[model samples]
Target: MGTGYEPLEVLKPVADDIWIVDGPEIRFYGMPFSTRMTVVRLSGGGLWIHSPIKLSLALKARIAALGQVKALIAPSVIHYAYLTDWKHAFPEAEAWIAPGVERRAERHGIPLEFDHYLAGANPDWAADFDWLVVRGSKTVAEAVFHHRASRTLILTDLIENFEKDKKPWWMWPILRATGIAAPNGSMPRDMRMTFRGNEDLLREDIERMIDWDPKRVIVAHGRWFEDNGAAELKRAFGWLLDG
Candidate 1:
């Protein structure tokens, strides 16, 4: 909870109906970490919020003008920090849980509740998006989504694009050690190392995503890949591509 950082930014549209915000800062790993949220207006005129950040009074008002906030998602156990706030604001929005998160969230005292689990797309959003499970990491498992209407792929922690300058000075050394600094941001070394024997399963999923040939890719942190997303995605997870 950083009160000293910049104001919450106005939501700006990136693709046809996709808008992204470099959102509120949350304290993580003993320091503040920046956050990002993606909002997509589905075919039925309903809003699908991914990796939701805190809903402030102004943000809530702006979001109301968008459409009904019909779907709420916690893409991974690590991304659930603000789901409770959003769900509290839009009670009618259906909360969807990612696989392996129900138990993880509970253990962490998150008490996440879900109307549906994301093993596959739900009927409400299936028409608008396709999904796959990044089923390798013992520490971080997440669901990756492809927003078909805008040709944008949304990922949580599987890929991080944290810029070095934007981070605090203390994080610089850690960022270098973790290999998630700007310019060449890709799948974190910690995450990649965990894939170990499950390389084929993760590679198969990344291959399907590459096939989508997304026009842009929105990772949870740092600068998103606005173009050449397919190639970047293939390159980011390059470690898994090999046998």
Candidate 2:
């Protein structure tokens, strides 16, 4: 999948102990779309997986190779589609849920035995790192993570990365209208419309993320910036702030 700017393939290690799996190919649906799942190795050898899309036997084997699957983190309610598969593969690993995921899980008949729920501005589980929930977005309670050491920002549906020229015809008008289109090609309009009435919270939350002075920004649907990440974030969220 495109991170809305540059296109990449498979899981690429952008930082030490952090790997990003770009999505855009709905391998099952046979449709082109942008999606991503990030895998991280915690300081203590536990592994954390965020926004995982597909968990095939081969992928699971690969993940097992990285480290023991200590936890499966669903960054948003909508991102839990593959949780069952991942859980089946790693039954011993606990499932961590964001806010409002239980209802969605039940509706989809997806068992959510969430061992932890991210509450308030600071969560105890988050040691040495910080995150915030974009309060106003109707899509889902999206918990964005900012890793201090790597200067990385991990996101879910909050931001998208897809190039207009690269998108199918039906997606163009949607991308242009929402102001997600960037000269760099990430966060096309498909995701911009989802930000309705949540601009202030998003801007505030993102400002908090930037205060950490991140050097890299990893978007689920787009490319990850290796350099000048804060600038890229400012550019990405500028419209929401200005509006």
Candidate 3:
């Protein structure tokens, strides 16, 4: 089994105004996997939490010291479990929903309502981000955000960079089978299946992302691209781009 990995750690800085908190390890399909939450400090001095993780009192205080939690977002359906916790803690924060998120949450027995649906541009944070709804997936849709100030692209599950050495021994086969078990950080094959016939639509979105020209990409699972982020992104999504 994977050992030597820490869980529920403190928030660490990834870049200017960007912090991440590592969360507990959990199992999916009998494989050990971990989760993480990303926090971005907005220009208004408020905070925008992306795909929030489990909240501890210590972590909560740490975040409070940073700024008011202004926006609590569920980047996608599967990433919303901790939304309620943060909402209760920061009731004043807007709980924004991504495209097709409401229905997915409802179907999954997760009761949550979106205060605002993410559309064209958000007046509050629009100046700082470029938002897109990743289409072509039959079962799921993810809202991707690119932070202009930090030159960082934030995604919940589009691409996973799993460190094979950090994962349990039993998970190797499954992770490899999914095409997400390290060596190279790329979109998982299972998620690719969700795209199915939506190749063109998905490609269009990727093309738009390329225009942003980000310097880093943060993902919810596994590892994030720290340098040459745009190049890595193009490389990872080559399947659609090449065509």
Candidate 4:
């Protein structure tokens, strides 16, 4: 029911104005996958929430104490499950989704609306974050972010570092086979195949992320890097970058 990162829905500060919440696990392709969310209080005092999890009254109260939720971001197509609930809670918060998310939601009959499509750095929160849509993946174009203030790189499925001990025995082979096991996780192999002809584009984007020189990296699933962010980026992405 819960991932190793307990104390769900409570804000865990990562840096000034930035915090992360570890949420309950959700099933993906019949496998239980852990979920996490990132919250950032913008300079103007509005909250930016990334990949919201199942909402609760207690969580809502905690968020209200910080600031008004202004932006709810669906960083990838598959990460929009809780957007509708979050939208109902913070109607004023603009919902931003990646390119293919709208269609994915529609197919699943999830009635969700969005105010902006996350392409490049939009003027709305550009002052605080640097972002990019990881090009070359025809199936999943995840929008990755770098918080300028905290020097933290925020990613979704791009890099999953699942700890073996935290996962069930049945998931060990799957994790190792997909190369998403902790201490050495990279992009999943199947996802990598989607970029068959466009490795260069992905490499370019990874290069830019490495250039940002993040201090830490926060991922939606699994263990995130707490320090040496750039080196971790290089190491995690070595499979493609080295080729």
| Winning model by TM-score | 4
**Total residue pair clashes for candidate 2:** 15
Candidate 3, residues 52-154: lDDT per residue as tens digits? 8878888889888888999988877778877888898898899887777788777788767557877554558777788888878887788898999888999
Question: What are the Cα lDDT values of the candidates?
Answer: 0.80, 0.70, 0.81, 0.90
Which of 3 and 4 is ahead in lDDT? 4
Cα lDDT of model 4 by residue, 118-197, tens digit:
87545578788888889999899999889998999999889999998788899999999998999988888989999999
Model 1, range 1-243, lDDT digits (tens) per residue? Answer: 332224565687788999986677777768677788899998887899998987788889888888899999888878887787888889989988787778887788876657888776555677888787777777677888899988899997777777766776778787777767766677878788878878777888889999988989998777788999899887777766754
From the highest TM-score down, the ranking of the candidates is 4, 3, 1, 2
Which prediction has the highest lDDT against the true structure? Answer: 4
Q: Which residue segments of model 2 deviate by more than 4 Å?
A: 1-10, 27-31, 120-125, 164-166, 182-199
**lDDT value for model 4:** 0.90
Which regions of candidate 4 are displaced past 4 Å? none
The 10-residue segment of model 2 with minimum total lDDT is: 1-10
Clashing pairs in 1: none
**Root-mean-square deviation of each candidate, in angstroms?**
2.3, 3.7, 1.8, 1.1
Q: Please, what's the RMSD in Å of model 1?
A: 2.3
Judged by TM-score relative to the true structure, which candidate is superior, 3 or 4? 4
Candidate 2, residue 124: lDDT: 36
Error of 1 at 63 (Å): 0.8
TM-score-best of 1 and 3: 3
